[model samples]
Target: MAIGPTIGTGLFIGAGQALAVGGPASLLLSYIILSILTLAMTTSMAEVSTHLPSQHGTLVTNGYMYMSKSFAFASAYLRWYTLALFVPYEITSAMVNLGLWKPGSTIAIRLAIITTIVVGCNFLPERLFKSSERLFTAIKIGTMATLFVLSLALGLGGVDAQPPWGFKYWKHPGAMNEYLVRGVWGQVLAFLQCLFDGSIAFAFAPELIVHHAEMPASLMPASVGEAAILSASIPGIVKSDVAQTAFPYILSSLAMGVMAPFNDTRLTNNGTGSGSSPYLIGLRDAKLQIVPTIAMVAILLSAVASGRSFLYLSSRTLCAMSELGHAPSAFSTRNRGNVPYLAVVASALFSSLAFVSVKIPSTIMNTYLLRLVTSACFISSLVSCATYIRFNRRLRAKGMAKRYSSSLQPFATYFGMVISTLLLLGSGLWVAPNGNLTGSRAIRLIVSYVNIGVFSLLFLVHLFKDFVSVAEVDKQMDLGGRSYGNRAGPREPRTQKMHPHRGGVYAIPEASGASDLRVRQTMFTEP
Candidate 1:
């Protein structure tokens, strides 16, 4: 699930754009920096999940337990909504990929067909979903390994092209490419551009650690460490691909950084589609006929797998909302197969929004969707950090802080919060070509941050329905639960009892005509 959609066009197709604007050295450095920040987020999430594992473990639940009810409501809605859009975005990208094989195809039909299939698959039993996810993840990993080896071979002068590519372009381009205003300011802007542009690739990934937070502390160290390391490696490997093979493959068609010029007509400006991918470009240049086809098919399958996973996650998020009483109880309903089919279908409906892409230019829609996703993800990351800080405080209050690992604690949480908050604030600037806030600029800011307004509205709506004081929220929180003792510091051979119907720390009255908002606090316990 983490590896599938994550390795989609963002790294494969979008890396070229990052390479084009930031050059090799700048892109490489920026990615390394972002990777650390991403690790900070993953580590923080691991701590919370370790400390407070729930059947529907989410920042939303953590928010309610450690913060205000309003905060919880906003977090829950934001996550469900943000995650819902990903289904359509991946589907749309897949349609664009299909365009590569058959130009001017009817996108609407293809999108609907694909979305239906993804939604239908979610209705299957949980074990089947897990099995298929494992298969897709394995295939995706194999694809990446193949890419690394093939690109490495190409970099070693596998083709009888120019001189053996050994960072030759890096010397010519001198690593960094200048952007926006010139001089030192331009360099600063160029680096920031790379940072912002490259960020989308890693969005929502750190949250994956939460999925495994229920495991034993001893088991967590490896999974938590591996999640961060794997995510951080994404940009490094892709940047290396461009540095070694993509840029060097067709130097004449590309700009100074050994990548196609920023304005290259072939580049997928929308940040979707593999038609113009640097890896595909290298494959084409090397005259590998069958391999390029296989690579494209792999990309398509990755998109499908990612779409499927997003649906699975969306349903889970909805279940969390239902359990928290922020969403309709119907969404909490499970089929005989134990599938939250209502939430699955509700989430899949967001994919219908992809039809809007059919009318708008692919590049325009891509930019809008990319910025939207980036902003929401940054907001969600900050929420995670805040929740972790509050959770730690509760642990310390109960004298359990020492019982848990503080390896990267407060520092990473604080650092990630600050960085994510700053990025979320400035994310709108990327939408505007010039920094000036003109009419289009103003609109772009609103569009990019529409999620913030929506989240705030959600908080207000919750306030109207179930208002609670901050003091009460903290006082009622169940910090003393036995689940908190399941930290990494201690281990027991006793068979831990599994309690599926643990009560919540607090409950809110249902708003008028909001019967489905009835709350239940079901949690996951390790055995």
Candidate 2:
């Protein structure tokens, strides 16, 4: 389930750009660092969610539960738009894969076709959606496995008369490329750029995984035991097997580094389809035919599938926000299949942004969208880390027994917080006075940091409107425990309750005099 939405055009196609700018060494190193950060963030979330799982999933709802309403409101919108923008990012990627990288009616037609299919799938009954997701997830795993094997074979001289090329490209390109400036600082910048680029692939992956695990049992796929295991033993499974859990991502990164040299012009070539993929470039260089086209087709399908998944996630996030009064309440309405059709339509509208590529170059458009989404991802990560810290402190103070515990606690979350901040701050450094800054460069600079401005705007606006003093918020955090509401005075301790549908135990604050319905209603309702 994690791999379903996690692996997308970012790895298959966008990695080419990273290779071009940072070379193989930086690409590999950046991915490793990202893996570590992903694990840290994932385990921290798992620890929190497993202790007091929520029906609304872990992102902004957790912020509301453990942090402040303003943070939650800001992050809810931030996450909603982040996932919504991803629809176009993936759609634009599909356009690139279809060789329609230019502006025209052709791009428009293909955009409409892909958007229809993606949006249409979300309106399906819940069962059909889950089934389609599983099918596409299987295809993604198969494609990754095939690419890994092919990359390994190519590196070992499996091609018809080609000699073994193990590590040759790394040595020739000297493993590190200078960027912006020249010298050690340039290499540092190159590595940082790689981190920023690579982050797009892993963005919000942990949240997706936790969200899937938190899904009602009826909505989960039958074959996905990992979700069940996550519900039962998230801390143990994530803490002990983080490396194993991350193996596919790590292996895919290594496979890309081995498939082609970073200096290959094809890696940066703004040409059609296969030309933009380092893996496909390697296959073409081997004098092979048909296979590259086949691989491109697989990648196109993967992009479409990823777009569909992100659409579902974004819509659900919007629906959750609506339930909390952070968005229009109409979004909370459901159709016959229990799907939030209004939220789906609202989120799917952003897919039209993919048409922006019709005017701008697809590659450039992809990068801009990537930067926008990546910045939002950094903010989400920062918020999650902060929520985890406070939640952990609360648990410790109460001497509550945790369903999941990690040795990396607090430390892992702290590390994640620092890395997220550095990446967010450095994301737009490319426009820094390396040379003359043109109008286009100025636009790029604004696009890079625009999300940060938007997040601050949302937070301040909500902060003023919410108007709760810090002392009151802290007091609520202390007394409210697992619930988030405006209720005052001492309350009874939280009591364990069995979830009727999920068959798992959950905690709810014991109401001193409130009715059961009121207690349940106010659990996730805003103050």
Candidate 3:
């Protein structure tokens, strides 16, 4: 749930953009398409989690046996580092939104502020730390629900029935084929945005849960699932009609216009992320009298939630890498708070470059574009899924003692890999063909090459340190629980038998490969 759902969901914001690009009619089509795609990806993720779930989710242990721990560490490092690029950007966005610090503040002063807050949080007891975070999450959710309810109210009695506030814009929409590419591209980008949003927020949550003193034994195999659930909660908390704005795709519907403004009582523009994406813009266009304070708070909260999450994730990855022997030994040592002081310091130093670039965000169309939060993450996701498929396939083929495997062996793995690759490829091809001023294709080329390139270089340099054969890499995977490898093949008509209980909780040992799990020993450990 974390990576799949928790990733920075650009969906609501993306939906608005889809309406603009694909028009109202096609917007619905795009949502249907992407939702299916998302479901498929989630299934692949679920299958993997059912087997080799770990704190890093699918990224950590899927290929540990096939690749060296160093390889796993490298994948973890690059994804974390790439994702880390956004933390400073999120902070900068919120800081700017708050209008708290003066624009002319000295660099040292800003750094000191960031350092102080981060260090202060480290001093709090664990319970206080989490409670505070959950508080923000709750506030964000409340604000979102309030916005939807109010938007609906305004939208209800032709609320404030104003000019440019009806469904006229959508009624003039074109054929789906006309805006198909635009719709597809726009929504795809939105999905990518959503992925980054959710992924960044919860990527390290499993690691966070793992450190807790009393994690549920069931949660041990659910670290990854937990992340997905949290991610899904955003959409879950808000009804789909409201949440759909997170992606916003209505051609000529009543929703075509109408957005609440800065004041509490007026309707204006619905801000879409794209040209027409600013929710504020929608509120304004509706001529609603929304106060500006609402926008500022939303912006600040976005920065706080998104920024802090990414920073913590980056630090965790650094620590994980150090533990796995991928980076300098200094990172392995944790401080009194179990914080990886050296790794945190080192990562903060590297992530600081974002400060320089983000400050000069005039280099791009908007401050947000500079984040590049999702560029490399999708690539890493594809790699992680593929590695699992590959590792597990070889195991099943040899008739080895399969501990925890998926229902269809590596097919699910292949499915995820192919789809993720296709999405990335589609984006890549789009960027490659139509170069932007920044030439994001060039940036992608650089990021991927550096990973593939540097890893190759590093591997060559330290070839003698640890040589892993395909066979050895195949052996290290431990699907501690929930193995479905031996299940009957999918029926022509697949059926799910979910016998639910009160409070929406149902429990049982439903997996096929129970032999690999030791219930008495490791069952009740932390997630």
Candidate 4:
């Protein structure tokens, strides 16, 4: 369920977009490249969490621990604010299909449908909501399996036609491709769009994956790993032969024609895995309605479950940031229900901005691009990860107790950082004019530089406040121990107590009595 929404409706649609742009070879190449990048980055993310997973899953909470409030705030905006306010894109994408029922339906009808789904589904209580999630995830898989069976049959029967120029033809189309006619600048924007599209899945992972195979218990972690393993292990996603044509692969079979990859209400999947809903995109058309129907239902179920989980996740992000003195305190305050009642209402209000998406003119393709959300989230996560690595190294150097990693750790951490920095820079500024850092487009071009700005602005403000001496911070950090002055008595010397509770076990409540500031900080600040 967590993974589903993060994965979004995009993967199902990416093929057509890719086909229009670069054809089979290019699309497959991009998928492989992005997949490797994501894997490395995620593994690095997992590695840090293995040592220490923050209570606040959004980038802000973890970010504030190492970075500053401004950095954390901007990151929160980049991830949560953008994400929370992203109703227009997501809901629009979710509802784009409804028009197929009544061709040329009025925007009112479409908005109503989207509104109904987004708002109505959220009204359900938590338990029933989660149960439906399990049920829906099952159905989606069953349908996907059926699609694969059909794709295999079609493949065996030779119903789908392969491109005439051979598999690699699409990869080297020059500038003549319809999708790239916008010149290098246009091409750059297009790439950014798709890259951003790819990020949708990554951001949603924390929400979706059950146990990170690393995250500690007592954190009330989420489990959307079902979808992830399913995405990874599904035969359709595997490609022993990358040179094969696109039709036979997952996208064409499941999400392409049936789901119609480019029907854009939001700038979703863009018809490519980085392009479409990868799960649906992977499956093929099954003549047996049960299979595809079940899949569609499952996709919908994921959307529904994600809505609740996201609400909880988003509100709590607001709450956690508030605890860190980044977000407004009221927004962070919780009700007796343990709900960030104000934050939830605020999130709902913020999400209403998605209504503007209704006016964007619904279509099978979207003009609005949302790649920034992906870039910002990944940037924040990766930077926090880089900080985590530093924290761990410092802890180890100081003779602190910690787990040992083999060769994989050093390589993955550094590799992820370099690659993350490159991807962020390249994806944002590799193109020109619009990205040329001059004239009216400079702001937009600079917005493309969100990652640098995210880090810089936060660092500068933290420097101004003197939160941590710039020089000392430049030195290795000690994340396991926080620095508190006389207000909390002389800071306790750094110590390790076996992490107190087991990792990867059931949740345990941390002590939160007001008298014990350390425990309160542990329950709150430690995120």
TM-score of each: 0.76, 0.83, 0.62, 0.64
lDDT tens per residue, model 3, 1-527: 22221222232232343344334445444444444334334444444443333444445444443455455545655666664665555544444333322245464465457545654553444456556766665665554555555455545544466533344334433323132245566545544433332232222332222212111322333223553344333222222322232232222122433342112111102221222223444555555665334744564554556555556667667776556445678877876666676766665654455355334421222223432444455566565666656555665777754333335435645665665565444443323333233435566455333445544554454444444443343344234422245334342322222211001112233376322211121122112
TM-score-sorted candidate list, best first: 2, 1, 4, 3
User: Model 4, 178-278: lDDT tens per residue?
Assistant: 33346666654555444443444445443224222322321432243332343233122212212221223334323232222233312133321122342
After superposition, candidate 2 runs with Cα above 4 Å error? 100-105, 214-232, 239-245, 270-275, 396-401, 433-439, 468-527
Query: After superposition on all CA atoms, how large is the RMSD of candidate 1?
Result: 11.8
Candidate 2, 359-423: lDDT as tens digits: 76565566677888998899999989888888877778878777777787779899999999999
Highest lDDT among the candidates is held by which one?
Answer: 2
In candidate 4, how many Å is residue 134 off? 2.7
- Cα deviation at 311, candidate 2, in Å, is 0.3
Which tens-of-lDDT digit does each residue in 437-505 have in candidate 1?
223767777877898888889889877654344334434434542233354444333333332233332
TM-score computed on alpha carbons, candidate 4 = 0.64
Q: What lDDT does candidate 1 reach at residue 99?
A: 71
Query: What number of backbone clashes does candidate 1 have, counting pairs of residues 3 or more apart or in separate chains?
Result: 2
